[model samples]
Target: MPAAATVNSPRHAMSDTLNQPTSFSAIDFLRTKSLANVVQAEIERMIIDGEFQPNERVNENALSQRLGVSRGPIREACSALAAMGLIEIIPNRGFFIRALSSDESQDLSEARAGIFGCMAMMLAERVTVAQIAILRALLARMDEIVALGEVHTYYPVNLEFHKQIASMAGNNRLGSIYQSFVRELHIQRYRALSSPDVLHISNAEHREIVDAVEARDPVRALIAGRAHILNGIVRAKKAQQAGEATAQAKAAPRRTRRTAAAMEETAAGTPADAATKPRARRGGLSKTD
Candidate 1:
């Protein structure tokens, strides 16, 4: 019976072996050729995944140990990320994940709106039936995702939908510039979508953009696409203001208590109160005498 069991175990092991890849491909070797780029991509993924919060310091030593690489490649990766605007270097301190200020976020949104609006206009003039079909399919998928209240799941799809529009425009230089803008906008959009209400409003704007595109009206498409992105700016600003208001509300009571305690101390230590009490002069005589 034991021999039969061993024979069955060997058969199971063989079946598992058959399911596994026998060897790595050429692409695998190409990925390892640039250690800094590989490390940069991993760190960028961590930032996008919210593993590292905005302005949080990245621990070089800890990352090196975890990634099984030395500090040199890690430092190089940090510099690369900084160049890409994903992280910032603090001179003597270290690298920290970048967070855009409200004003900066607004500026980025406006810039993106102009570029994307142009792309939409261009696509409207030149888009084929197949391209329109692709955009419609993505819109349908986004609508389904939003209906199910899966806002988080819709972010990547939203990016891909815009990217497809940029690609369909068929301007390589414009596409390159648009890609950079989109990369920086990712974090800002994520913050805006923190409120579920924004999801419905945003997708509604997306539908308008698609309608304008399908109608082959360049001016209307430009307006729709640009308005959608500008509205994103407004939503991002509102979210920022809401966060600030909440933080201030939480700190208000603490500030009030501290102010009250300070006032009490000041009253107790007043010169008028001290003057009411008797005091010996320095020469062992009262001032009245």
Candidate 2:
């Protein structure tokens, strides 16, 4: 029988607060853990689902109040997110959610291409029969999701599929680092090029990658993966440019809207004399009776 697969366990850090044997210390530790979990889950969900919005400032005070946690925990959570590249920290200016940019997206895509290429090559060299079967099953499921048009369900599964393969490549450090960058990269790409059709295309490209890997062709898999990432980068860049153009185009209309609103308010606030012209009646201007 095949041996059970081993998974890495989460590492726990020693706490300085552990020295305090009082109930208050215990409660504080639990509270800190809860706060960190809540804040991390909320922020991650917002970023992945595009609810937080790009280039928006994260209001730490409001977030702390909403989460029912103190500002300290909120600050700690924001620091963690910033470390994960999910947010941009401007010194003395506070944390802002990172925006999708063409250049940045392209750079990430190129890096992903190189990393994923190396991973795929490694997997091709060392993947076991069981691993191959697992990959095939995942690819089948992915195809099923595509057939059913379940885009949302497919997205996370697809991410996990790639991440799992990267993990199986026998280098713990490489897999860990690759996994760390994957989610943020996906979120950025999706922000720039969010469309059902494009997602379907991506799935098809993934199919090609799986086929190459299953064939145990290292060069083929590497090339396919690199090409897929390169194409995605191109598409993301175009989408980012398009987004910027659309925003620029709307600027004029936005200004016009603001001007019209101001004029309406001014008209509403004006005295009657400013709004109505004085008229002469019977060759004389009328005055107070």
Model 1: CA > 4 A from native:
1-33, 65-69, 101-103, 256-289
| Candidate 1 least-lDDT 10 residues | 278-287
Clash pairs, candidate 2, are none
- Poorest 10 consecutive residues of model 2 by lDDT? 4-13
Off by over 4 Å in 2: 1-34, 148-150, 245-289
Report the lDDT of model 1 for residue 139. Answer: 87
Report the lDDT of model 1 for residue 248: 100
lDDT of 2 by residue, 174-228 (tens): 7777767675686765643365566668777877887788788999888887788
Looking at model 1, how many pairs of residues clash?
A: 0
Q: Write the per-residue lDDT of candidate 1 for residues 1-289, one digit (tens) a residue.
A: 9887876897877876665665344456565669888888888877765678788999999999999999999999999888878889999899998988867777878888998999999988988899889988998998888888776788878888889989998999999988887767677777777677778888888888888888999999999989988888778778878988999999999999999987987877866556654453433555456
Query: What's the lDDT for all of these models?
Result: 0.84, 0.75
* Candidate 2 TM-score, C-alpha based: 0.70
- Among the numbered candidates, top lDDT falls to 1
